[model samples]
Target: MSRSCSFSLCAHDWSAYQLAEQLGRGVAELWPSADRGRYAVLNRLAELGYVATRQELTGKRARTIYSITPAGREALAAWLGTPPRPPSVEFEGMVRVLLADQGSLDDLRATLQQTRESALANRDMFARYAAYISATGGTFPERRHLFALANTFMIGHYDHILPWTEWAEQQIADWPDTVTPASTNEAQVRDMLAPGREVWEHDHPDGA
Candidate 1:
């Protein structure tokens, strides 16, 4: 909830259903049961006086709408002022590739293919989302700048994944089997490692 406020103030008025849908797409997909989980969280926030809830009629049905309290805004402001931890990478595809020698090469190839497909799908979805936000300014026109920056990063991530998986798949194509070190392409490995080595050596002049 605090993180949502950091992105947009209008998020203060979202219903739990809306929060679940928006968070599932724009942020991390809620696990287990998003709707139930968000409803429970919203109730807790209300109990803590961080959010206030009111019943509003939508046609024939009445839904509970939550709005952040002054306390919520203060909490969100404090969260934004704090420095965030470093980004973490948790790519299952990369993990499989790293340990591929201990498993079947076919499994690695399938993982790469699945990764590429997932990236493609994400790219297409985000492309449409960007277009929507660009054309319509989305729900929060005031925060379009933040959304633009985030969408750009997501697009770049998918762009990198697509080509990288393609390159990895090509490398796997030439391998005879998984385990043999003799099947490794030493020159290709060195070429791939060159940029990192150069940067590390440049930073540590004494080779420390």
Candidate 2:
């Protein structure tokens, strides 16, 4: 997904300070190449007429609050309307796991552990957002509905990854010293390993 979409969503219901903090945690660290800084991203959004800045004078000093403009919403909608590009994540941890056949089991464990740790961290992050939404009694029903969906996706993602990583760690820990390939695709190999779990493994006469 484009950075613009994430930024637009952040401004949808949050103040500038909140957005900056979230951007720092989510985008700045996740995609540092695309990000300059929190203020720079906000300013770019303003320059493009996709975000509006309002000056608010607090008791101490002035602050800037940003909101996504009509154009911004339209842009975001257009992005959502089209099919997204293929996933091209740059996570080196996964890259190591992909080429694990060339490396030692210890290296595989270390790389998968990194991914597992990352998944747990992200799980905690979204759990806080989920708690916030819950505490508010589902405030902003429409927007919060989508935010809740995103939170659910992230939570589910990590939930799956956590167990998968654990399973992978165990499998690697007990990997055969002279194992050879039985299948090419992971799903096929998984089915070869799993006795009767997946329905897709069945040859249905009705093709149902």
Candidate 3:
């Protein structure tokens, strides 16, 4: 399977490379160059009759195309019904912030700037994706509603990132250094806790 399989999908036929691209670009990180594991899973699915594979020649090369069987759809539906684990973040910039005392304030500021820039770029990317889907009607027009929901979640994630980085930057600007003893901003802390506190108070009024 190659990454450049085809831009078009014939029914539900998908190459292993295509699946890797979808997973990586959408939500997960899958390296196409080291795709032995992905191919193994696909092969296993074929063995279980969840997916069927066919060889098709594209020019001088033959590619393996896979289509989900009824069993595969059933498996997918069942998986979807299960509760997913909470989202986990693997951001190097956040790690740097967590260890900011080990580094200079300059380093922390730079990391914050980089994080904000990345969030901005991701926001633009999602905007373009939404616009493209709106204009060209998307690759799967039948699944437009699902796509919109996914896009909203992705956009919301970046939206949260941008504001958080901005807020962190503002806080850092008032700090003399990463290690120096600084007084806490009580107002800021209270503001940050307001929403949760309000919810808690509403749930348990008058300490009841």
Candidate 4:
């Protein structure tokens, strides 16, 4: 995905620089490599039939914002209904977890401390964005909705990670002597059969 395309996808307006800034912010938040993040956005836009380019508007070099065609809006609506694919997690604490044997308890603690700080900072930023959305009425109507959704997602994300981090810290302090793998056979079996059950048994029992 090109940066241009990705920027266009999320933006209601088509300012290239603004798109670039948003791309940078997304890269930081999502932790993808710069090239990959830009390309992903471009690819998605292409798939949706939206072109990203700069053109002269009113004799000024301005981003020629392409309006979403009816088909494009329909595609976006369909895409929105599906859960976003999980971004690759590049969290530093996970690396520390893998190399915990190489480091002392203090090192682990520090790593976790830094991770928590980063999470809190991110939470604050999202909160601020949500506030901005509430304050500004003239920005994209859809953007206000997207901001709310992003805030909700961020809250859930923090809620999930904060607890896990706390649990991990406690576990490290207590220092388990043995690790046991839980049984996942039943869950795995259910997961494997879940699609067929939903599709064949529920949605199309008579083979439509």
Deviation (Å) of 148 in candidate 1: 0.9
* lDDT per residue (tens digit) for residues 86-110 in model 3: 7667677889988998989999999
Candidates' C-alpha lDDT: 0.74, 0.67, 0.71, 0.59
Error of 4 at 137 (Å): 3.4
Clash totals in order: 0, 0, 0, 7
Pairs of colliding residues, candidate 3 = none
Tens digit of per-residue lDDT, candidate 2, span 1-208: 2354355454464556767555554443345554555556667777888777787878989887777788887777787789976755567777787777887767788888889998899889888878887888443455678777777877887798899889877665546521344333456467547755455447554667
Candidate 1 residue-wise lDDT, 1-208, digit = tens: 4455323323647766777667666565112233245546666667777787789999999997778788877877787789985766657778888888888889989999999998898888788889998899987777779878988888998899999998888876878777764446778778778989999999999999
Error of 1 at 87 (Å): 1.1
> What's the true lDDT of residue 169 in model 3?
87
The local distance difference test score of model 2 is 0.67
Better of 2 and 4 by lDDT: 2
Candidate number with greatest TM-score: 1
- Candidate 4, superposed: residue stretches over 4 Å from native: 1-11, 24-49, 57-90, 174-208
Instruction: Give the distance in Å from residue 190's predicted Cα in candidate 1 to where it truly belongs.
Output: 2.7
Model 3 whole-model lDDT (C-alpha atoms): 0.71
Relative to the unseen true structure, what is the C-alpha lDDT of residue 167 in candidate 1, on a scale of 0 to 100? 84
